[model samples]
Target: MTPAPIDIPDEIRAQVYVHALAAFPAECCGYLVGARAGVVDAVVACTNAQDQGAHPTHPERGADTGFVIAGAELLAFARAFDGDRPPRVVYHSHTNGRAYFSSVDQDLASGPAYPVQHLVVGVADGRVTEAALFAWSDNAYVEVARWQGPREGGSTA
Candidate 1:
């Protein structure tokens, strides 16, 4: 069965958006470390590690359409976490456009690496157009929630 969707506050959403905007023209990826309780306590930016040209796996595809979280950095991040608070989400932005997960994303997320949620941000013109939460379940990636921005009545954006 699929898990319930995460309820993210507007402030946290804004932070991620800012990161994506700042990295415009280049996809930005990172890990969200926290409890399984589904609250994002921190957004740690990870190097995309995608070489601009001639990626080992798909030289033709190039780095513009891919991202790699350096294994060494990942190891150090896990070591620093103390095992109590583990990564709850893996997030990245589609710098050029489109919010949907690509086949490459599926191949990467399929590892069941951490069973954490996956968040994709849609960026265009240095602004976020759409963003959503996804999770790997059963044998595929499932959409969990779409960001609705701030709530009404001056909830803050």
Candidate 2:
């Protein structure tokens, strides 16, 4: 089966880029909104649970960054908005290189621990270079959409 498509708005893309750049040399993290055939709206700042490297040799890898969203935090965020909506997207950033879901990212993506879409941001040379979104289907990871800024093109699949 094909994975659902997602549309990331231009404004959120800019913010994701800024956040990723600010956390350069270290992994940055955040969350995404929207699911199925809906408009992707809002990008929330999230904690980088893995502040340090999982291994001694790779200290800058945010792929190993285990992300957790506290219920209280979600509840607080939920109350501010009107109507009923589920927090169905999770995001994070890579301090260096392109945006691709790492092994650790895949594991987390497919895990039942969080029922949401996964978004990854890549920061390189003091800029937000890449962005990719993914969703799990049939026990595997599938691409959703990607960010396209003035520097690079966007991907939506």
Candidate 3:
């Protein structure tokens, strides 16, 4: 059965926006940790290892179009499932200002290397524009929630 939608608090969402903006022009990747099953309480910012030319499958692509969590961060993330506060959502940014899972994303998440949902942030012009949360359902990942970023000269409400 499909799992219930994970809950991301506003502050946590804001933190993600910040990470996305800070990595503008390049994709930022990270995960959300929760003490329980359905609600995330913290955001763990991770380095985007794509630009390091170490991405196992797509090293030719730069961070502008891809992201990979590797090395120490990856080890920690994998080990967290056995901890008290495990990650419930893995998040990444799209510098092209679109918040949909891409073909590469599908390939990486096919076997769902981890037991977590996905949050894709859309960023352009150095600011976050939109974000979408997806969860594995049936044989694919599907959108479960969405959040709109602050408009130009406006606030996030």
Judged by lDDT, which candidate is best?
3
Which model, 2 or 3, shows the larger TM-score? Answer: 3
lDDT of candidate 1 over 1-157, digit per residue (tens): 8867665666777888888878766778887777757676777888777744434554334323657778887786667456766777778887545677778888887866566778888877656778888887788788878864333366566
* Runs of candidate 2 exceeding 4 Å displacement: 34-37, 52-58, 62-83, 152-157
Best by TM-score: 3
Residues 47-130, candidate 2, lDDT per residue (tens digit)? 554664344466554445654445666565455344354456677777655677777777765664556667778776677767
- How do all the candidates rank in terms of TM-score, highest first? 3, 1, 2
Better of 1 and 3 by lDDT: 3
Residue-level lDDT of model 3, residues 107-126, one tens digit each, is: 78767767889999988778
- TM for candidate 2 is 0.74
Per-prediction TM-score to the true structure, in the order listed: 0.79, 0.74, 0.87
Cα lDDT for residue 157, model 3? 52
Native-referenced Cα lDDT, model 1: 0.72
Ranking by lDDT: 3, 1, 2
> What's model 1's TM-score?
0.79
